[model samples]
Target chain A: MMTLKKIAVPVAALILFGLFWEFLVWVNGWPNYKMASPSDLWPAFWKFRWLFLDYGWDTLWRTVAGLLIAVVVGVLLGMVMGFSRTMRDALYPLLVGFNAIPKATVVPIIALMFVGQHDMNTILIAFLISFFPIAVSVSIGLSTLEPEYRDILAALGASKLTIFWKIALPKTLPEFFGALKVAVTLAFIGTNLMEIVEPHGRGLGHLFDSGKISADYPLMFAVLIALAVMGILLYYIVVALEHVFAGWAERTPQ
Target chain B: MTDLIDIKGVRHAYKTASGPLPVLDGLDVAVPEGGFAAVVGPSGCGKSTLTRLIAGLMMPDAGEVLLQGKPVTGPRATVGMAFQNPVLLEWRTILQNVMLPLEIVPTKMSKAQQEERARSLLALVGLEGFEDKRPSELSGGMRQRASLCRAIVHKPEVLILDEPFGALDAFTREDLWQTMHRVKAEEPFTGVLITHDLRESIFLADQVVVLSGRPARTQYVMDIPGKGPRDLEELYTPEAAERLNILRQQIRIAQGRAAA
Candidate 1:
């Protein structure tokens, strides 16, 4: 299990980075308000573990709900666009225009429109951020199938629905999971950003903002570490699912 | 003999930027029921295009393709096809891939019956043990065999193959040729194969039709005479060699025309 080949340098570099952070805190005699050492942040995390967990759970649920909606809607629309050239030509420009809009800039406006409801604002933000990649990736993946496959399906006298279900869906699974991986990370980011602008009753983004205002550097560092862990956990969930469904995507052609 | 599939003075051309570039120039061919026919020509000679026409994937600009005395307006399940590349659905198991046509076609059989038919077809193609394996998990030759199973699962009146074994290694290709011969002998469906391999055409086809290059035309059609379905031993025979030489000469002429 210990594959040491080529990983030593990166591991060493990470260790060096930890030492540099510790060295910077010690040498500069930085005020606790400005920077928290590992010792301070560790204890702060333990003290507020339950509060952090509640906020993390709220944020996590909002992200997942919004992402699920986005994925369902995006993939359906993308399939329509992929199957019909006229629809693609008609809708793709609008999609491109929408994607170009700064989603974060509109977060406050969306919060106002939704009447400052925490769940609604967070969902809208996540939905906006997560939908584009799924749509684009699904369309591209569906359209890029080999021509010979199309000919085979046609020769079989396969109905349009049969072709879509049997060929297009399975062929697009790897790309769909790939796009989901990207979309999930974006969903997390969008949720947190929304919480910052429109602070919910309880959430990690609200916690981070509060730490900033109160000069709670140790608490802030703990929240930052928690955010990193959350992102990794979410990403790995999608990665694991990808492995289960489209494991052949990873195999190099022999 | 009545033709199961007929191509009558089929003139096909594509509208290019320069103008209409002709592919098939007034080509006429016919496959009687239970006939094994091969179309052999040089590469780029539109042999595959002719197969496409017969399969109803594309329509000729002039004339018509008839299946069972009916003009082919679009694809029909009664006509099955295989390509050089075994275009199996990567996600489905071999059994599921073979079951595809049954699911698509409007059939009276129950799901269990459909599945049984698919299994039998797979077994017929010498893929008895590969029912659960995905197309990606199978070897190239194995995938082609699965493709054959899928093609014939619906029990089509005519099976069209466009160099289905061209991508395999030599050993695998030869082995598949025998497998194909055995399958044909057992089922007795009309087969139309488009291949560049002269020996493959002679070994598998009851009659081989040689095409002229580019704007392809049926230049020659030779009957393959033997007592039964051809085997590898037939390739070494003087009769097979004479037929192969004649086909080779036709291909050389086709290539010369294409170059010109």
Candidate 2:
């Protein structure tokens, strides 16, 4: 009953929001080209569902590829930073500085370099944008390799690599997964940014650009709805993976 | 009996930003093979440091820490240690945690053989059904029990315990004192326990060594009256009470909390 009430409030709020948007457009005497109402947007969504799926699939795969590369690179760099103080001092500031730069500005430069291959630019830019959080989290996790646990391993005569494999990696899993959830969202942001920079890279961003140029307001709102749902779907996939990999965490009493 | 663990004229100190903070100065400790010895001292007197030195986790500044008459330059695989906290890997099952040391130090024993030993050790500690449970699932007492099992599963020549029950409630701590005694009795490893509780030390240790304040040096050593077949009830006897009082007084003086 409580959970149902929780669901009911959100659904009711959504309905009120849709009605409010409809009323605002009506009050302004906005034309169809300027604004899309709930009624018009619903039917338009059904009509362009296939197109949304095609472009959504493209965006999703590019995000996944970018995130995959980010995981590999970020984890390697994070390990180097975590273990070696000298290397961390050398590389950490550079990573933070690189991460600080505007990814949007970088995307155009990448698009220029790749030219017609905007898809590669999209993935590369997405990877660049999403790399830092995972690397930083992994380094933090490795560094926090509990002193007590390390001492126990040391007392047992476990070598450095053995200690890492036995204690550090397993200890860092929750942090790794936590970083993944954040990285996935950042990856989606980068994908959308790149697609907007070069609409030739097929995705919801391209559809959004086409909607604007043609002034197909209903189609534009529909694409926006599709992008939101796709983001939600991908985020929940990472959440489910977290459950699979770190289920013991859920069962932890404290 | 030969000394399984021996520290002669050992001096250890840590460097702080302020200056050098001395902890142990010309300290000596020895435990005979298969004997359980407890080192009791004022808090912050570096009792844990003593355990670390014996385990070869740290190099002593000026003297030799020997296990079976060889200098301990680094952590030797034959030294097993269990700290106050259980420190079991949360990701591993109790059985797997017990079997962890075998993975670190290569053993000729087959996986199946080591596994059987792990299971048996868990069973010995009354954790048979809990073999598959993660450390977080168990109570604090149970986790510490598992930690003890893990330390002994590899059958180290010397087992170093740093206040294994210091965090437990009085009742649980007492319960585990029996458990500790039982484990030591059964396994017969040369044992060194670092604890604050004098009763606990007297109840479990064959000889209780008391140390003085900072830059700790042995002030006194009480041979708890027993060779074998000791009981907890014996702790309350007049002779034991006098000994316990002496031990407490010595530690009190060591901590500068009371007159000698």
Candidate 3:
């Protein structure tokens, strides 16, 4: 019953939002080219459903693959930076400089360097954009760990590796999940940026670009709705994982 | 019995931007095997630094700390510690927290045996049913109990408690003191308790070592004169009162508020 209410509330709000958008468009008497109503989206989706599915799958896979690579590389780098003060000092400025560069600007450069390899460029951009949050969150989580916890393990003659496995990793899970949630959204933005910038005739971003070129505004809106739904789906997946792994961190009603 | 923990002429200072700030100055303390010594002083008297030195978590600059006659050059598995914060891992259940040291220290017990040991200690501390509960679910006093179990679960030769009960309410603190006695009866390790509570020092330790003000050194030692089970009522008795009085005066002297 509780779970049902939890799912039902946001879903009802979404329906209300759709109705509001439809009402605004109708009141203004805007042409579909100016602003597509919710009513126009269904037909556009039905007409191009197969293509949307194919393109959506391509985009989804790229985001997922990039995020997976980010998790592996980000965690290792974060651990190194978190464990050693010298390494953190050395790497932090570089990481901040890289992250500060707008990922949108990097897409053209990536296109220039790896010309015509659209999928890899999208994946690379996604990985680069997403990994920074994960690394920063993990390092902050590790460095701020309570000293007494380390003292307890150290007094036991536990090795640094053992302390990481037994304490640091579990302690950092909540923060890591927070970063993963942020990284997932960033990953999607990265993937879409590459597809829109290069327009290699693949992924949902490419489909959206095609819609814009043909003046199919409703189709473009439908593709956008598709992207939002995908982002929401991945976000919930991460939330579910957080519940499974770091549920203790969040206080539940007794 | 020989001393299980020995600190002789230990001096340490923390180097700051201004200069070297001394903490422990030529401190000396010892606790015989299975003995409990409570050290009390003014707040910043380096009592905690002494605990760390005894646990081998840090080294003193000028003197040596020994455990079982061996110089403590680095951290050793034979020393266990509990702090005022009761810093139990939130990710672990009460039972897993107790079993942490065993996982780190070299041990011959199989997994089942380790679980059994932790379960027994939890029961001893009146936390039997709370074995599977996460650290956050328990109250502060209960979490401190779990922390105590974790410290001694490895059966270390020395247990250094740096004000483990300092944060608890009076009732809870007294209850835990009783629990401490019960645990010591069964587990039997040398203990150094650094606390400000005079009654707690009297109730828990065989000897109370008083350190002088900052740049603390051992200035006085008072041995409680009985060797059997003690009642909390004894704390109000004339004999215990005299001991408490002497210790209070010693603390005053240590703080530079009274004549020596």
> Chain B vs. true chain B: TM-score for each candidate?
0.95, 0.96, 0.97
Q: Give the higher-TM-score candidate: 1 or 2.
A: 2
Q: For candidate 1, lDDT tens digit of each residue in B152-211?
A: 887889899999999889999999999898888777789899887888988998889988
Q: Candidate 2 on A89-177: residue-level lDDT in tens?
A: 99988998998898888888988888989678889987999889989988989987767789878887788898888788878889988
The local distance difference test score of model 2 is 0.86
Better structure of 1 and 2 per lDDT: 2
Evaluate model 3: give its lDDT. 0.92
Which of candidates 2 and 3 reaches a greater TM-score?
3
- Candidate 2 chain A, run of 10 with poorest lDDT: A245-254
Clashing pairs in 3: none
Q: Model 3 chain A — which ten-residue stretch has the worst lDDT?
A: A193-202
**Candidate 3 Cα errors over 4 Å, as ranges:** none
Cα lDDT for residue B102, candidate 2? 90
lDDT tens digits by residue: candidate 2, B89-195: 87789888899889887689999999999998888888889999988889999999999998888889988899989999999988888777677667888889999
Worst 10 residues of 1 chain B by lDDT: B251-260
Cα misplacement distance, residue B225 of candidate 3 (Å): 1.3
